[model samples]
Target chain A: MSARVFINEVAPRDGFQIERDFVPTAAKIALIDDLSPLGFAKIEATSFTSPKAIPNLADAAEVMTGIQRQPGVDYVALIPNEKGVERALACGTDELNFVMSASDSHGRANLRMTANQSLERFEHMVALADGHNVFINASISTAFGCPFEGEVRPERVLEIVARAQARGIQGVTLCDTTGMANPRQVASLCAEALSRYPDMALTLHLHNTRGMGLANAFAGYEVGVMRFDAALGGLGGCPFAPGASGNVCTEDLVHMFEQMGVHTGVDLERLLGVAEQLPTLVGHDVPGQVVKAGTSQRRYPLPDAIG
Target chain B: MSARVFINEVAPRDGFQIERDFVPTAAKIALIDDLSPLGFAKIEATSFTSPKAIPNLADAAEVMTGIQRQPGVDYVALIPNEKGVERALACGTDELNFVMSASDSHGRANLRMTANQSLERFEHMVALADGHNVFINASISTAFGCPFEGEVRPERVLEIVARAQARGIQGVTLCDTTGMANPRQVASLCAEALSRYPDMALTLHLHNTRGMGLANAFAGYEVGVMRFDAALGGLGGCPFAPGASGNVCTEDLVHMFEQMGVHTGVDLERLLGVAEQLPTLVGHDVPGQVVKAGTSQRRYPLPDAIG
Candidate 1:
């Protein structure tokens, strides 16, 4: 039997923040309410970043408080810094995810600080969450490769992950922020990281920009990495990377995993129903293919002899 | 060092046949001429099926005779029967691809015969091409799973492939006719087929209806299958399968392989250029993702902040 893999839905936060139009807190909470019972390990409710930086997620506190918490699901929020962490904790978020880039150039563009500054700040945030019951997870953006810096060396990514681990972070996410990851690179990095830090919970946050998102995820799985991040309707892309596409579609990823006998605990039909609502909410067609194509077992009737 | 993989371009035949408007003969010749030098092991130039069945490929003779052939490339023509074999031989085709479905339901729908009758006809077609100095390759459609039959037994597929092999066929293609294959199924089938017929050259013809095309291709590669068939712009879905998508995009497949350090010997930039031209010819936007989102190595300039 295959081991169980975790599907962490990041649509409400990562997917919504990139959209120019504002999704009201009620709709966001409603979607999360519908998604809560679909068997995801976590749902990233919203981001606690500055409203000026990301106007779409200005209702972070409202969304975090508004969602009817599912018994088994963790409601998480993205924390930009200490202020964000304070807001997240006050909102009663079950977990806090902090972002730092592996490359200094990307770090400055995304976080408005160098990699070192972000790493240093994560330590203080960890201390801030010390007394709280909330879990802490750190994400290393551009871990596979960077848009500005081009190919990010594996050593740079390892350093950032190592620092996060040293700070006693519960989980560390290696983000392929620009969708520039390949299977071999992912396999190599995952092998090395898991070999070195066997105890650290490693997750992969991949984008389908170049259509290699699922391919890279499969590679990571081959190396024994279990957790993955995806968004419904293929929403979310790196705002800094030019021409980049959305995150891997959660339904498509779940479809692939379920078909391969990898248990993800996701109800595909219900998840697909949630994904079907994305086009109206996002005000455009989504990048997802599974919704348009249907599942593999969805068969067509036989045509007559003339047809 | 990585082993070299063979890419067979099937857009001219498989892709064009599905379109409503007939591409001009001159345009077809021009596209094939452009594709000839792109380092594909073979180009499926055209099909010799009855015009009533596939009107788009009616100019088979013109297409077979019109192009300038690259020295290392093999120009192939699809033969539907003894009549098609005669036509292909007259056109000086390098190889003849005979197709028969593994399931009788699909065979009747596609070939107007039962599986056994089609296999018997293929044996006759083999004799017809025996002294012509042309190669013979047989394709088993619905080899993975059939849309009508629901689940095609693996034993049925192996029987057809073994019969083809016994007929002195050099290459055999296991076609996922309606994109119904999952990675585990592909891996298992490929492993079993390769183990039984160690000398037979196996190729995978996959579709992306459920978005597992690249994942399935990667699985096949992992199981020691080196040859793959793809359409230029994700064109060519099974006409019989409702809501079906296109063939695995050639550029997407090449991108995955090249990123994983596997060599396909195809120039990606030039292939993308050809793929870009497919929209006008087919009168619709192609399903390929790499053209919209450029190659992983295509780097963007950094922002002004010391980037």
Candidate 2:
């Protein structure tokens, strides 16, 4: 296993998109700017989807332009089609994230099309942005299993990746949209994906819906995956999938990996300070454990009376 | 690996003991009876500690005597001293659980005695109950690490196990008192314990204080551990330890294991129904993931509008 791993912070986009209340553009910019220097390999700054689909992210263009840029950080924006691509490119997004479901039922339910049609739409976006300097990354949602469809085949995901690869996409994230993955399943699928696409940079976007998110991440790590996508305080989940909870918490994931001797290079205390502010901003408690319970290394003083 | 594993339910004793409001004796019995037929290998019915110490469990004797017992189910009780042993034997508990800290500072702080002193007290109880038809299980709390004293050596746990083994104890529970255990640490210590005492049965009692409860359990399971302790709704924590959260949730643990094709023999639906009742019982939301997110295999219907 590598001594260091990379975390792509997705709370500003993935987390905030699911909230009912629209966070102010200034607040979104401030949170992203606060996280810019926290040693994140990538920051999913905002999404270029229509305001009608996600009104919370309507100020995406302003937030994208407002945040102070760090030198080494890759600022990413989620884009669905050619229109989103045009918007993201106009804002000078460092990376554009395209997504489609591996399960046809999920694709139909989520994107109003089949998997092939979504891939074709992605191809159109890729063809339209041919001269742009930005990198393109694809996410296969419900890659492990889908709520609408009981099980998703690995071959289907591979087929989607093959299409993305043909369109010159270098990275793909396999998302457990409802957190239905087990460790052995994760190990086997990740191993299979690596075997089939040796050069494609793979990242796992897991949710803590069933509390197996970190376990799945560890299994993926054991099988040689070095990149993961997480949200601050486990912020987001698919609204369409019933019983789906939050994404894996960034601070919690970093704490676990760092405790296991893998370096994240992110200051946990500072990250925790940011996570602590999430409840007040979002108006409810978050699902992250490390925020309520401090890191394991925190010590307690002995009782004075010893009763 | 075995197809089946044993989960010892500790909610009644471990979870209820920490609550500020005392659960009624009849209610405790009702919950235990409800859990009796849900396929738990063992249920820690109550603790026979002094009423003055833990007023929440002051009705331990009544709760133990009132529960409806199921065939093949081992109903256990926690016993802190000779007085507790006497009370437990009177209630006809199948197993008497004894506890000692692996760290001397924790031992002094929790039990008001040294580790050696606690072991001697256990030996006296063994002699006093020589002819009794009951099993003895000792838990070495802070086996992984201690909040009062940092980094408890594995040798300390080994030493306690040796003493318990010499006194004819059938099993030993290595508790992560403050949930400081990582996967590597659990794997190494469990391997060493098995190597040193090949015939003695080992069980892991982990806390989810740092959100590593299931990960630690998986590590232990990988290293030949077939038994674990968990509370329903993830509803227990150390009263003395600051920032301590709940124990690993029984429904969540069984959910993960069952999803991985490991048979826990726990009925997920029935267990969930019981877990659903806990929020009202405790007057707060639980920490269990499955209670909120449902099982990984749970399917959702496709949206009619798909908008």
Scored against the true structure, residue B246 in model 2 reaches a CA lDDT of 85
Clashes of each: 0, 0
- Model 1 chain A lDDT-worst window of ten: A298-307
Q: What is the TM-score of each candidate against the true structure?
A: 0.98, 0.97
Cα error, candidate 2, residue B156 (Å): 2.3
Candidate 1 C-alpha lDDT tens digits along A1-307 = 2378999999999999998799988999999999999999999999999999899999999999988999999998999899999999998899999998888888888888888999899999999888899989998899988887788899888888888889878898999998989877888999999898888888899998887777778878888889999999889997666565799889999998997889999999999998998899879888887898888777667786535
**True C-alpha contacts between chains kept, each model in order:** 0.70, 0.66
Error of 1 at B285 (Å): 0.9
Candidate lDDT values, in order: 0.88, 0.88
**TM-scores of chain A across candidates:** 0.98, 0.97
Per-residue alpha-carbon lDDT of candidate 1 for residues B184-253, written as tens digits (9 for 90 to 100): 8898999899999988989999898777788888888888899999999888887766555789989999
Using Cα atoms, each model's DockQ against the true complex is 0.67, 0.65
- Model 1 residue runs over 4 Å out of place are B305-307
